[model samples]
Target: MRKLGCKPAVTRHNQPRLSGLRMMARKAPARLVRDHIDPAPLMLANDQIGDCTSVGIANHLRATASLAGYQIDVSTGDAVRFYSESTGYRPANAESDQGGIEVDVLGIAGRDGYHLDHGTYYPLWGTVDPQDRNALALVVAGMGCAYLGVQLAAADQAPGVWDTDRTGDNTPGSWGGHCLLLWDYTGLGDNDLVTLLTWGVRQKATWQWLHSRIMEAHGIIWPQMVLPSGFYPTGPDLDMLKADNAAFLMGNLWQVPVTS
Candidate 1:
């Protein structure tokens, strides 16, 4: 059985919303995935503990690095350590294994930094409009991935394409909250609109399912990292994004106008 460990996102008064930024003009691909590197999932100990939040973070960074033409692995043990470091989950004390909040963890990662195999990578993380699919495609295409928190339904227990249920059993959070990493997405018109990583496996779910179940979505960028040759991102301006994140952390609400 897979364990869900993501708590509802902590709301900040002036959370940095990516939709407010001026994004690139190029069209996002109808489908995108970093599977060329064939990165495998580590499960990150989610089978036994509620550390999906940390697992999602580890997986996202691994996928991003793979897309950039190198491999940096996040083992199950590493993820467990991260969960303890981030959420204070202890292996011996199950009571300390309580779930984590996505935004709070992301904020910490951005402020402190995440230690991967290469070194500590400081990420600029922020929320995005969960209701906007076009914006989501654009974000994922550019960043190589995004992190999602969903209210799981009972229907999620059975493995197949996760979709809505008509029997009133698909109510959000009916099962619990789970965190997923969005690494690939098909077009908005497709039934299985996105490919996400959860429980150390790839799962496909409809956009409608995502729209209804998603409580929060976030995007992360590593401005200090450079991509491999031939990979171009159609995302936000790094400079403006940095400014906005700084303002968000400092308790100031500053909106940079989208320039032409």
Candidate 2:
């Protein structure tokens, strides 16, 4: 399969590393999960020749915005246009129609700002790593969703069933590269399964399937305002706040030290 021109070379330093911290696996009640972001309004009907990357990113932004109480309608056409303009990848060329680059699409979203009905937009943080079930679960439960880049075999794409039992080798050369979004994940350890949105439908696959086939996995950070009700702030968020408060207290403008 053709690779996107904007696809960056995978490197050790940039790859996602599991947070080593242990986290409890709690499944949100089916009723409460239904109340979270809905995939129906955000799915793409059909993407341009090689615009799956754009479609995945756009859908992710749209879903996160919806969770934040803002309705964002971004069509596949819009995503393709953004990718073309941001990456200088001409869509008209069949040879260069590949569009599965995360940085390019996320950069465009941050720069142009995702269109909202109220004329305000928010930025998203992109995180990449190998398969981390706890991290994936935390992101979906607290944030909105996670976007995944995987190497897919012809069979994996066909019925769209990505169970681990399907195959043994899931390396890059063993399959074609593709991008999709992970909206929901359940269970723990070896039993964990994630729900992916691709080509206008949701598909299920084990975390093992992801571990096997995922060349790159991106967890898009949702804005604080959009975090779900039961969400707890991650360590990074708390650390940033502490650092900011300390800096403020040390500055001449605010000499009072934080007692708490």
Candidate 3:
């Protein structure tokens, strides 16, 4: 797990600002997944030191705007600056330095307004229950993406490979606190794998790994963005339906129904 650390103060550089343009929200597709989301136009969160937090936020903002038919690329350097301004932390002195918090990154989004070619994005804060897979799935399915702070083990840091089978025994060791963007979820039950946007690529992690490694999770709710076109029942949703059907059947209502 990566522990949070502030970057040392340094000379700041000029960065691009968000455009104040706004666009109309269009209806989303009936379903979405890693494959369903075209990766081409989406901005990649580069692998930089002490900047995972900014990358995560930038990716989320870009994805939200893209879904609404807009092209928006949030500058990671600007995001870092925003983080510094909001939290009173010094700018990163080096590329490998570790720093940032989810709240501060979100504060920047709220303050400046996430602008896009089509429209601006407004994020709604929501709790992330990593232990509750169904809840996580619902947020991702309904909201498009979730931001997560995870403790990564050595095995978890393997580049270009699906990180699975992580356990609690794996210590953070020298790894510092890190953040990333959760874009999609696939499969069900014990086979579930979360698709995360990190290091400029989409990575995978099993539910087991996520439950064990995730220290904090937050849903980036974009009110201006449209929800999925169709309903996708989650584990709890299915369970509730099953319970309702059983209750109705046990009441013997079907045997008595014919009034119409």
Candidate 4:
């Protein structure tokens, strides 16, 4: 069985929501994953450590960077380092290897910033309702991708169109808590199909399956994915959101924007 890392979704007291934000692009394309990128999974050391939470973030950073006509070289060591720092996991201590909470990890990264090869990137993430499909689509269209935490079913281990498994071990969280990046979507209406980057490759799953298994979703706005003015390239008032996040989080959490 693959290692599952995400612990669970911890609700914050005053997290920002995208419900009222004005989206520059009302509709997202049927698909967002670029054709030039390879489907080969990076794995990012998740095969050995329960660091899917950090691995998911690393994958998003790479995907967004690639989509924007550049590259960010992320390594397994980077992922494992972030995981160890954020979740208190030690390579020599098995007891400290107990996964991590997705929101907590993101919140910490948002406050302290994540160090990458190029430089430190301060990613601004907000709570997104998993049940809101339109909101999710807008996120992918506007923010580039969505970070998702999901409960894995026993049948999910087989992989290939992770639709509902009626005749098998389909119980939510039966397997474990896992995390993935939702980067693309196709089709229309209830039949929409979404592509997830996880466990070292891209996987397809039905919208229904995502709706059923998803426990938490967040829209992450990478520093490099935005315009020079600190706004999202798609035109969301990212500066305003950042200001709100600064206040909602800790003391001057987002006092300065990281343009490097």
Top-scoring candidate (lDDT): 4
Q: Which candidate is the best by TM-score?
A: 4
Please list the residue runs of candidate 3 whose C-alpha ends up more than 4 Å from where it truly belongs after superposition: 1-32, 39-46, 89-98, 111-121, 164-169, 172-174, 227-260
lDDT of each: 0.74, 0.54, 0.51, 0.76
TM-score, one value per model: 0.86, 0.69, 0.63, 0.87
TM-score of 3: 0.63
For model 2, which pairs clash? 16-128, 16-129
lDDT of 3 by residue, 19-119 (tens): 11011122223334667554322222234345566666667766665555664655655555544443444533443243655554554555455554445
Which regions of candidate 1 fall more than 4 Å away from where they truly are?
Answer: 24-27, 33-37, 166-168, 228-236, 252-260
Q: What TM-score would you give candidate 2 relative to the actual structure?
A: 0.69
Put the candidates in TM-score order, highest first: 4, 1, 2, 3
Return the number of clashes found in candidate 3: 11
Considering only N, C-alpha and C atoms within 3 Å, which residue pairs clash in candidate 4? Answer: 41-200, 41-201
RMSD of 2: 9.8
Any residue pairs clashing in model 1, and if so which?
none
Q: Which ten residues in a row have the lowest lDDT in candidate 3?
A: 15-24
Q: Write the per-residue lDDT of candidate 2 for residues 119-225, one digit (tens) a residue.
A: 53444444534555656666566556667777775457446568755555544435567777777766655656667777666777777777777666555554434
Candidate 3 Cα RMSD (Å): 16.8
Task: Show where candidate 2 strays beyond 4 Å.
Answer: 1-37, 41-47, 65-70, 115-120, 167-173, 222-225, 232-260
